[model samples]
Target: MEWAEFTEQSHKGRASWTAIQPENKRTATDNALALKEFFQRFPEYQNRKFYITGSFTSESYGGVYVPTLTNLVIKMIQNGTLPNVKLVGMAVGNGELSADQQTNSAVDLLYYRGMLGMQQFDSLKSCCVDNYDQPLTYCNFSQFVVVDDFGNLSPNNNTNDPKAIQCGKLITSFAMDSVWATANDVYNSYQDCYNFTSLSSGGLKGEAGRRTWKAIMGSKRLRASVQQSQDLQSMFSTGSNPFVDQGALYNQGSTDAMGGFACYMDSATQVYLNLPQVRKALHIPDSLPPWVDCNIPVNSQYYHQQNHDMTPVFQSIIDSGYHLNMLIYNGDVDMACNFLGDEWFMENLAGSVYKFNLLSDRFAWNYTRGSFLPQLGGYVKSWSNYNTTSIDLLTVKGAGHFVPTDRPGPALQMIYNFMHTGNYNNSVPFSLDPQPLLPQFAAPPKPSFTRKQADRVWSLPGVTYELNFKQYSGYLNGVPGNYLHYW
Candidate 1:
């Protein structure tokens, strides 16, 4: 299924295209209709139950679209328009459900992380109080700090003008740093930045290069342009901004689509996807514009006419009487949508929505890696409405914006357990090794590679272990003069 054309187009460009065309509005309902049409075309899968999931901006979209789609499906089923199409539940990671709450918590996270000094933080508290719903001019905190081009922040020693120190540029500086600086990755703070020059000079090659690329790309952060940073500042300036109005917060510019914070493997992925053969294999039409990770034009034209606060939508679903589950997970270190903000949203929902009761105290979930002992994966808190519905809020401890990419093992375990058991519990240890053999069964043959050349390429450096699987690489025909490489 596809989003409205304007929404898709806005994501491709850097500027707002539909700002001039106010009448050209788009919302989740359009996508719901498309999904309904898709189900109609395939009657055989009409009654199948499905779970929805999304990350980042898509997560934000899911908060609105999923419920809308769910209600639409319910109506269809009631009217016999669709025999059946079950909407079991949904999961969202680092979602922007409430912009005001997220922005406020993002600043608070930075302060807690030592990004802000006690004096500066005190000053901010004094000026803006705990609430960030005031005008930008009224709560300017940036004047007290100095932010360099590299995104580094320090106290402004030039002067101590009380008016200047209100609350102006601190968030703006951090926002810019998240986009251009290497030290502050808004996605996964612990991951290394991928240097484009290194890739071009063959610094990353072979299996080692592939591993490095995977690590970098797996934890890659989203990039917003300087203008986008300014837009964020404007968003803070205007209290209670909606995600749609603040395009820069989610939309990716050309450079962002090309790589992301450090140009990670997206550059290569873009090249590979645009390859003539690859596009043809994917059935992409020649007339369509080149594929990009995000389309700025689509973001610019998009509109959410519905209430910005999605609490009502969620409450409506819970009241709908259908058994459902919802999981809102966040990577603790992500500035884009910090865990604190989501925690606040969930807490508010639990208090305001009917039938929800605290089911479990917040507890640590753990995961085991290789031969190492189990480690803290994250923390989880849950609420339930008897046996009919459930909601959970979780945080992946050291991860940033991209939970799965930043902490794949923990993410996989958390998601798997949640999907199967309807809760995030890692009490039982998980293992990768096969189960012990039965007394009657014969032992399997020792794994071995027949080809020496292939073995050499696939061999892990400094490791001594028997393999259960083989690895291979190949080259594919690209756009006439070029070729695509894959492992």
Candidate 2:
């Protein structure tokens, strides 16, 4: 689709789509049809079994929410945004793409946004429909990550920079084209240079774009699924009574039913008598009870159970085919669609791909405490019985809410390796493994504060009580243990 047409469809009633993400939005037939046509026009990805990936496929529909650390867009190398990347033209020096064709080629991302699991579509619907509500302003900027290209199906030991490798340029280039509200003259035209604060102000990416444009275009919507979860969980207090009211209302207010004031739970009516004014007394508002005002980000356990609603449709796609495989990549640091959340998702997924460790040069450790035990932030697998369907939850080291941003190299290699081996590669650690051992520090001038373990065999005399003479060798408040070893 041309950038102009892309802008038209993005705001036209279906006011919620971001052009470069893989979020699968439930869309009207016309838009879906248009998407299919757009992909058909692209020579590189027209056919040959296409599989889409990104945040859009998994994001919950809602209003203009902020971009949690999980918004993969910032991590993904969007086209010309990276060094030596070929946008509309080509890799500047590599001459891989022509400048004239780069813009059009990158614009193809607008198509990818429409093509992949249709996350952008779902996000669009949520923005324009599902989450429509008057908020701080009639104007709003909704930020939703539709698709993520973080290498779930990364290729093998192929160590080539993913950007320079096959399919890399194409995907990133499209991502670049998808940005209009922030950059690009094409999107700027529709933006009409509508000026407003960046979406980051509300602690969000403003996926909808400039406030001026959003207000003029229409009210942005949030996905109903996530909104529902947030709504329900928000009502419960961690306090004594998790719920204020349910089914029916009962009152034990002044009446201590059994001498001691016992909150009544009507098994039949499912109402609570302990609540101040039971449902029996109030005019039950049409919406959630007035007492529900809590914040439950998707990353919280409150919203943890909601992901089951987001099982990727692509899972079935892999099962439907024979010689194919699919992977679901997640960055652990993403507070929203975090690594742990993905882990929980995989645990629930019924599959047969073998589960194992990611052996990389990065930090690796096994914790003895089960609850506090971290996966050391690496990959764990969920595979299919026939070796086709698989989901590998790859954890990033020291990564917070966003993996690509902090550990882009590992994320990139993960995808590269996935594409290389249709199965998990236990050999590749998260990084170079520090195999040479960081130069050893010439014996550290001491033994790393001492590995001597306290129980050492002393061959010398019993006067063993050595003195530091006031200052000396080993580690102590100021004194060295070695000084104590002196006679």
Candidate 3:
């Protein structure tokens, strides 16, 4: 679709793209027709099988559109409208399938990660009924702190009650405030936040730095209010903002470094995509607006014409008897579309919806990097419908919202295994037999390098050392400056 046709100027003077609207049923039919046209143009490849993969919001779209497209193509083939096209399966990573599950699981994740106080967690669980479905009059999970568009923080409705104010501060400190403040890089908690100033100032440099910046820019999105704060009315109403809301993302702090693997203030991707040469290569017209990670107008103006819960669509595909396989994977550390909620969704599908027999108990999957020993990559659970269909729910340990960027080796191995073996086990070659030990050598003399040189060496990228003894080292507060000392 052309960019102009995909997006339109809204009455609010914003560009709204219809392509990514969650409830846009026309997208499926369009996609199916596009596929039909593709086969018509290239009849020789009609017998080829295809598999689909999507991440984040695209994953949600895939959940609905992929199956719908498949069904449409099957009908077309039966009716002699189009040639036969085989869809083998699909894979979704950190997908936002159910708003209820995603929203509730985020709170649970906060509590589990020690980001919420015990009392506050208990209160939320009791009052909100373990979810965000309760009305504000009954339970105000986010009522503690109310932030405005100008980054001003105040008590909810400017309440002067002492308890309310304290609760607000507590929630702000624990839930909202982090390394990136309001734009708290919810995708990955442990990653360092970056900005254009930092990047341009040579704080991050060299090819390694450029790669890191590219990865961050490519993954980040303008995810303001898109991750949370959906009202019941909007969720059910058509032509309403079911995805994006006027809640936390805007009110908190700067959304400059919003989406992606880490929080970043600027998008290198936007800069690159807008370049004249790049635009010419991609055939982007000059009349289109400059590129952005996420279309804010589209997010706010999208219609929820389709079912939010996509389990039925998935179940329909499985029952279609197309020898289908589905892989629903999540990064364990991702709070947006959390692993727990996705796990629950898959478990419910297997146990109740499909009545599929459990093929494997949840077990640790390992991955290796460089010469490092095999480490726990994540956990996996599998379900099978005899031999016709299979579903696997897997988690990538220590990964954030973007699993491929977070754990590239593991992610590649996982997808490779899924395509071939239909499971995560034995993704890479492994051997139980022990190899011959190397001959012992004399220990090297203590280094004569200066402390600065040692620091430089230690800070070098991709450097790892095997130490004989455990060493504890950390930064310490000082009068004028912090001290980095080892004990």
Identify the candidate with maximal TM-score: 3
Question: TM-score of the candidate numbered 1?
Answer: 0.58
Off by over 4 Å in 1: 1-27, 37-46, 55-60, 74-81, 128-183, 197-263, 279-307, 352-355, 369-372, 426-487
Going through the candidates in order, what is the number of backbone clashes in each?
24, 77, 3
Report how far off residue 164 is in candidate 1 (Å). Answer: 12
RMSD of 3: 18.4
TM-score of each: 0.58, 0.29, 0.59
Cα lDDT tens digits, model 1, 288-381, are 9897654434432443224344676676666667687878888887665567777877887875656478888799877766676888888988
Ten consecutive residues with minimal summed lDDT in candidate 1? 1-10
Better of 1 and 2 by TM-score: 1
- Whose lDDT is higher: candidate 1's or candidate 3's? 3
For model 3, which pairs clash?
220-259, 220-260, 257-264
Relative to the true structure, how large is the alpha-carbon lDDT of every model? 0.54, 0.29, 0.55
Worst 10 residues of 3 by lDDT: 1-10
lDDT order, best first, reads: 3, 1, 2
User: After superposition, which runs of candidate 2 have C-alpha atoms over 4 Å from their true positions?
Assistant: 1-25, 28-35, 43-49, 55-308, 311-324, 351-377, 423-487
